[model samples]
Target: MSELRRFLEQLTAAPSAEALWDLHCSKMAEYGFDRIIYGFSHYMSETSMGDPEDFILLTNHDPSYMELFIGNGLYRDAPMVRWALHNVGACSWRFLWDEMARGALTEREKQIIAINQRHNVTAGYSISFKAITSRSKGAIALTAREGMTQAEADEIWAEHGSDIVLMNNVAHLKIVTLPHQSTGRSLTKRQREALEWVGDGKTTQDIAMLMGLTSATVEKHLRLARESLSVETTAQAVLKAAFQNQMFIVDGIQG
Candidate 1:
């Protein structure tokens, strides 16, 4: 319990999502879990998970494998992912295959399983976090070290399951509060201020007067902000920046 508390303290100090993922990977490795893929969806519905753009996916898997698994949409039928989409709480991957005997898995699911096995991704546990909103949920899948059979993996988890669950949940909680480079947007201070004014319902002329800039310069800042955020309009830029948690942030949101 003390160790978990210390880890939580360290977790909150992570400077960015990438740093958090790195710490999480090393921490999970200490418990014989060597790989993980964590995902958080901000916009979801009963029918869909909303735009892929609205989700955060972090993994240490090989790029080639992810190209096929995620890039190709094969994750749609991945048993653990499917489980997370529908449920909250942790479950063993062993339960995923129980459906095979019951003939509940689709042909596509079977193929994905076979592919996973070839990659030594056979044993793992899925933890689907409690939803923060009706349309938002997050989850993580922890894969045991290669060469460990399900029995061996289960043995390790049995001994440390409580700590693992608590640590991971705390990590997720800390992670969501950090800023993400979603959309790869890096707004300059001026661009950010421009968007902030726009977000506060200011027009170009108003922002120009407030910032002591010409109307043309204010428009330029707004245009650059839009391009940096990959949006077509100033309003969209503000919304996207807010979504990435890059707007309206006070200094030291993270310690």
Candidate 2:
């Protein structure tokens, strides 16, 4: 069997988000993209990508770079990020260079470029996945190793861009199917059970009887789920949990 086929099979069967990410990172590294940043949101809007806490973010970029780029909100002004938000398919970094050469970048965008250059994140490509929902968006940036020029990255893309986009699309689809809760947003088993029941249109009393708990206990679990998800209502909790793939999960695959 071909190596790509083997990798796709492994990717399809990956048991957890972390395992899928590890496989993807190694594969991209072989194509000269040693640093990667992937982000997806199911709750995007006209003005926002929803709360940062709710995003499914995977990256192997340096923590310091990520801190300022994402943590500090510099990505909002990043030229590539703006392009990813507005377009789909693979884009070469030369697009950014061209924009800079034409003096079209805003001051904030220039600052983002400056930081990226300092961290050797100068050469790469971005792939914007087709949105699965009207409000959903997903994109990834693949950064070449230090010292590689945009010309070199473009050459690699010219040869392997189609395969790289296919692999990333598959990985993104698999990741969305897996649970991806943030640290403080994880629900207890009971909370998850309660929310799943709620998603199935169960009343509090019905969930209590099904789970062998009192109605008040079920209510408490449902309440805690809302709190954990930082949502206001039980229905919202159910929706959020489902969005994160954290409800009705298979027993062994709970990650």
Clash numbers, per candidate: 0, 0
- Each model's lDDT: 0.83, 0.90
Residues 1-255, candidate 1: write the lDDT tens digits. 687778888888888778888888999999888888888887688777766655777899888878888788787778778889888888888886788889999898999999999989999888999988787889998989898888887888799888889888988887778777655557877888889999999988999999999999999988988888777977778877776777777655422
lDDT of 2 by residue, 121-178 (tens): 8999999999999999999999999999999999999898999999999998898999
Among all candidates shown, the one with the greatest lDDT = 2
User: Against the hidden true structure, what lDDT does model 2 obtain?
Assistant: 0.90
Question: What is candidate 2's CA lDDT for residue 157?
Answer: 92
User: What are the root-mean-square deviations of the candidates from the true structure over C-alphas?
Assistant: 2.3, 1.1
- In model 1, the runs with Cα more than 4 Å from the true position are 250-255
lDDT of 1 at 152: 84
Candidate 2, residue 180: Cα displacement in angstroms equals 1.2
